[model samples]
Target: MPANLTADFLKARNEFRAAKDRHDKLVALEKMLATIPKHKGTDHMQADIKRRIAKLKEETQGKSSHRKGPQLDHIEREGAGQVVLLGPPNSGKSSLLAALTNAHPEVAEYPYSTVLPLPGMMRFEDVPIQLVDLPPMSAEYSESWLYSLVRHADLCLLTLDGSLQAEELANTVEEIILLLEEHHIRLVRRKEITEEEMRVRDVPCRIVLTRGDLGDLASRVEELSDLFPVIVTSPIDRTGLDALREGVFVALDVIRVYTKLPGKPADMVEPYVLPVGSTALDAVRMVHRDFVDRLKYIRVWGSGRFDGQQVPSTHLLADRDIIEIHLS
Candidate 1:
């Protein structure tokens, strides 16, 4: 098989060749690693890039021995799931983050206003999901660490400026997609594991068209909806913000399972979040490892045929279902 290098990879390679300092070389190398195609043909190239990155990191750390501060390369996951925002500059990422989450990231009319990742918790009913606002993705401005954050995110929201004309908006979306692909991140609607796709991270994504109040977005929304679940929102008037929150929760594909004692009322607050299709046995294991072996059966509510109906350990749980573990 041929390596089949992409134009983006070649450009990054050239940047690496032209780099004057270790920092620039490291940045370029990160880009190269991200943009390089993932396949049997490029396996050797990938390994080489990894080796170079490891070496550059050691050198950079050695030179900055006194460097002290929080690490910017990673964000800790919180809430039920972590969702990272990605888009072109001035695409209303900060505005949307401020509107949807408690974090007050700087919202400016100028491009490149955001330089670091800021995270806030967004609540969808009783469940809270972590929403991270990342620096914009562009050829000249995006940081290499942003790609790493996206690769690890539980979900991705690709925001577009709804104020642009449909054609320009579409073009901006295309550019963002190309940049993400160059970095080996694939935005998918669902997790359909396959041999080829497994090589790269397939994070679920939702499209958010911000600045909905600025222009007519019906056409843009309709067109983009064909690609992914689309939500048109505006921080100015808070349009579609509610729907966006709900969409994020649904895109996570997780369910909230409540627990209760046999004689006590169900604990409605702080439900245990689990992936859809999880079983009662899984919940038992989460509660405690001891329960896994000592558990006799589970009584279910909400999804059960009747209230307090006894179910086997393997019984599947649904969202908002209440379970009471009965021990022998």
Candidate 2:
């Protein structure tokens, strides 16, 4: 027998939620509304979904003056996330990018080979995540634009050469942290609550040990644990590629949702990785204000009690769901 209506609904709902294309969300929303079963089992769900669909359409018609700006462009997920790679000269950022992604950045055994930022997409399970290699900075002084880029990134991957001693490595981390703090981009330890906590706030991060084969890499990672989470990887040894890929996704704060529909085959959609504090309204906003209006009912499938279960618009979403939304 085919999957139940709730299963199909959740699948499509998640697809729409994770959709990068605005129009694709509308299509998914329409399919969800059409395929969901009618009657008491889904009555309230159908009504609310319809209401949202209408609201989304009206909002798109320029009804709300509160929604106007360049921010619309910001409401997008072209890649996993905008992550900038930062560190001093010869920190192995460019080398790591060249190995992880197909970008052939200058990879000489020298300092400052990269004078400008080079962008490349690293695909994890076919989901393309952006990684930008920024120009190297020094502890004594950092360029203004370099600081700005790191500040704006959804996550920053700071590479530390394993060859540096414990004290030097700590100093380098402290310096970069200070630079980040100077620009109001502080890394918080979500695990700890303190006057100056190091939680993964709006922006999450991970330390990558480049040149992992070097003798001191492990020791340095151990020392840095007091500061931030670490991902020990070597583009040369290729020892931690898998872990690094997962780290990129985690730092991006995304979740994957598959799509299933009536009389349709299921497919894996892009990762709908929002920030830590994303809400259903935030998820809807990810699509467009129009869809938020027309959001009727979202039926979910896969994992947990909600698996193959239908819920109202106010329902929260889970990870790796097959969601379908029924709209008006």
Candidate 3:
């Protein structure tokens, strides 16, 4: 059986996932239960929702009975996905984050200007991705948070100084790679395998050539393409800003799926974020587990569809595809 789910249910799920407080989570769960389809297909999902609601209520009561000390935690990931900017000192990482987001990371020409993680939200079309600017990665210096930040990130934007001479750029990048390797991390193209290590973590990364507005720097950095896939940008001139936005979205391997009522149009305002190659059944399950057993089929209204064409539950979905689910 397939899960025939609705967009409203998915939105509530996101709210639950993103909620910072127990009260907010409880509110989101209640909305999720209300939005969930009342059908046999959703029986399991209904139970799961109720279970979560009960758990949250219990936790709320427990919280009122206990007081906790201040706790140190990593920057909470927000938006569609979390991405980090990593590079050597003076690599223009802060400038790039500042340009793309509202975050005021202290941009300076000298090294080690940023002392802590600075996070901001960047938008691609209507989708928001969390971008974090961390202290630079270098042979002599890197914050303790660098490893965890890169490891947990959905993608890493390797910011490089376009103004650096070719040889200097090569050395800087090589050192950065070695530093990552020491921490059991490796950067590679999606298909490339990491050299054997007890706990090697391979991260998907792309190069962002910053300061290209400087004399002939953009062209010089083009010579490094054999080194890695590169996106050139200049915060001063706003060059390649659009390309950077689109590149990050694609590199993250994410897609958005929209849902619709049987006879009404799909809700275009909000979408369910899923990885690429996600199927109709996968989407249904994400919307709510109960949709799994009762989902009869799905009708898609985008990309290769002839307007609301019926598709198998296993049909692969693309970004912006409008899906209408039927029940048994």
Candidate 4:
């Protein structure tokens, strides 16, 4: 018989796959074990999960005693989602990060100034999105762990120097794509994944034309706009920063849902972030997994025919929707 995995189990498994830090991975594994169907078919899987959890616990204890230099291999994700900036040396990754986020990466006139990943929270209206500025991706100073960062990113921003001629900029972009492809990472503009491309990781990407004030980039932007969403930005003049933030949020494809008690006012601040098309059931699960079983129904203030209209658990949510959960 097949293992007959459940939706909750599959969601936990995906979390495990996407987890970079050991603590997050262990939590996901525990959830997987908890949600997986208990049957003869899943006996081996259960045993494997148990063994991995044991090993992780051992490693976690050992790490406290024999900690070495700071490991930059993994960055704990923060805010809504992680967006990694990639490009050749002096492609303005550092400058862009400094301008957009609070991160103070060393922005210099020379190449290879950034040696590690620097992350900062960039607030877009009400949401805080993480922006990580990594070391430049070039033959001269690319880090081996850069591929892992890009592979796990929610969205990748390919920064290109707008001052370079259109042909040179295009060649640089091609080289960057080829280098990532060698590591089994295919950059795509869309979020949809297909079965045939399961072997390679498809990371959604956007093109950022930096140094927009330096040269006439109309033709350059026109050329690359056909392939990817192009955002021409100049950190000096603060041009296109707002548009970039909006674009990044759109690329992440998430919705914010506000929660309210049955008789209380809605908490407008810090809306719970969920992926697009997430249902009322998903929101309840996010609010508290224990509420799933006790969930009676939901009432919606937005995205409903009438205010405070009763909605079923399967009701799809929209951006800025206010939901009040009714539990048994």
Candidate 5:
């Protein structure tokens, strides 16, 4: 492994990380495979990339083979957000998902056990963040779906083996990042920088160690904390679960808003609340984008600083505020 070749490998990896779309990832993966020098040092990387390409091809074919499901229709729900869980086999992901939400994914003690993605709605302070438990990444499993999910995820909870050694942990994280990069998903390594400095590059990741009560796992947890937000807990101990839930909400970057109308106060028709970044016009646009253009006046009440204020349709709304729109 020449130093330059190693550098090229890293560069190609980053190119894959920053890729925007599926086509981009495929192109970057091909380039990454081409850039790595065909030597003993890169032999493993080359093989892994070839495997990834083949998997991607299979997925592309699979998509055409199956009819699209109704879930494809985009409908924003009250406080709805999406977070995906990524970890090695038997890292307590199924347990964590069961602990956090109503989702009853099959919990077992084996590798590649979760064959499909399980989505569950989790409530956190008037907001609902959808948590998905994905299949484990292993030598025997395809990493393609995991990569795709991580790229689209608002946040990622990287699970660690509570019984693994420090060197083993490092190696696992390195490989996870490599898969993420190979799929062109951007991630910021928590090591080598400060949290405030971390904001410069927007990579959403948190390190969570399951079964942390094991003696001396603190140091292992500490080691992972250097590169990402680290949370340690055992299912039995139940520590850090609240922090973990809050972290998911923070990652979604949403705020809640309530609805209000005089006589129809209790007539909540649909999506009763919305996320913070949502605009007054967003509501109208959501109903129909044409409403956004025709929106004339908005009467807002409750929950916001400016209660009972009549503002323009473009007025930015705050959490718990009630809004009544009047369109042209």
Candidate 6:
């Protein structure tokens, strides 16, 4: 299929090639992406443009542009899911990351302490969730790669200073929203984006207030609840960290199902994870697509009406459920 390239896109591509500075290059690339037609023929071109835009933004916004920020910025998702941290500078992202995971991202009082995407595994119960501390977002500095990262992420945690007054908190949120909107990113409180959101790139996100011990955060928390689901935390006391971990797991919207041979015990240690509300057939498909053809019926153990009861393939599986399949 022909790309059916537009004249505006051609001009923008030329401008992008001629642009010298990182910021200007990013602008031109975005223009090119916007002008390009969205279709199968242009998918590869769109991806290439996005990749270049991400690399340029990483080099320009991050303080460690001298390093390999461009290549190192794209982190593959691991563990149960990937959750990216979004916030302006001095929002205690590094401190929270250090406290939650073994990864130590430079924790400092100054702004722009973290200049790269730091990945760490955070344990919730027995499951691990990958949490990435990304470069700070502000009106003046924002990595273009950040939007794509969040769009691909299972969840997003927007951290803000809990000590800020009501006005400051509002202003900070406005700044974060404005910057993300500028990149055509929107944050919704839903775990799954609707079909209408595909065009806008709406992402599921929750607000996290760090340093809650700094001031009277109770009132602020109560006020913010009407707007967004908020979680308060303090790195010093480990307060709300557990809740935050659980919250992240919940945001992932996944269920763990253990499978067993007809006569053996279920593999409880490493349960197969699937999206919530997945049916027994869906679970079978995860274990092996071929099972879909051989599967007759699965016997449910946990979370079933009766222990060791047989359930239909369409039966919905809940978290921590165990299944024993009997093939004909």
Name the candidate that leads on TM-score. Answer: 4
Give each model's whole-structure lDDT. 0.85, 0.68, 0.81, 0.87, 0.66, 0.81
TM-scores for all predictions: 0.79, 0.69, 0.75, 0.85, 0.63, 0.77
- Expressed as tens digits, the lDDT of each residue in 185-228 for candidate 6 is 77778745232333456667888999876766888787677656
Kindly indicate the candidate among 1 and 4 with the higher lDDT.
4
lDDT of 1 at 235: 85
Return the lDDT, model 3, position 272: 84
Residues 15-46 of candidate 3: C-alpha lDDT, one tens digit per residue: 77556577988999899899988887677777
RMSD of each: 10.1, 12.6, 9.8, 4.2, 10.9, 10.0
Q: Which pairs clash (backbone N, Cα, C closer than 3 Å) in model 3? A: 3-291, 3-292, 41-290, 41-294, 42-290, 45-290
Query: Candidate 6 versus the native: TM-score?
Result: 0.77
For residue 264, model 4's alpha carbon misses the true position, in angstroms, by 2.5
Return the TM-score for candidate 5, rounded to 2 decimals. Answer: 0.63
Error of 6 at 185 (Å): 1.5
For residues 146-189, could you state the per-residue lDDT of candidate 1 as single tens digits?
Answer: 89899878899998888778777777777877788888888888
* Superposed model 2: Cα runs more than 4 Å off: 1-77, 190-202, 269-271, 276-289, 303-306
Candidate 6, number of clashes: 0
- lDDT over C-alpha atoms for residue 213 of model 4: 79
* Candidates 2 and 4 compared by lDDT, better number: 4
